[model samples]
Target: MAKYSEKASKKVEQAIHTEKEGKLRTGTGKKVTSRKQAIAIGLSEARKEGAKVPQKKD
Candidate 1:
């Protein structure tokens, strides 16, 4: 199992919340409707902020 930092978890939570509220968007401006995508976005953000997240799979 992969371990995520507190910050990464918080980011994922926030992303999920925003997605449920219909306020999350993708880079192309499309509304995010999938839970998996929301988590991906959160992890991406966490990675950008230097959170302890695992490397993205190809």
Candidate 2:
């Protein structure tokens, strides 16, 4: 199990909320329908903000 920082967790939660509200979109401007995709988006944002997120898996 990979460890995520508090900031990362919060970001993920916020993303899920946005997804549930149909406000989350992908880079291509398409709606995100998958929970996993929402989680990925959250982690990506967290990484950009310098949160202590684990390295992306290959």
Best by TM-score: 1
Q: Which stretches of candidate 2 lie over 4 Å from their true place?
A: none
The digit string of per-residue lDDT tens for model 2 on 1-58 reads: 8899999999999999999999999999999999999999999999999999999989
Which pairs of residues collide in model 1? none
Model 1 over residues 1-58: C-alpha lDDT tens digits?
9999999999999999999999999999999989999999999999999999999989
TM-score for all predictions? Answer: 0.98, 0.96
TM-score quality measure for candidate 1 = 0.98
Those runs of model 1 whose alpha carbons end farther than 4 Å from true positions after fitting are none
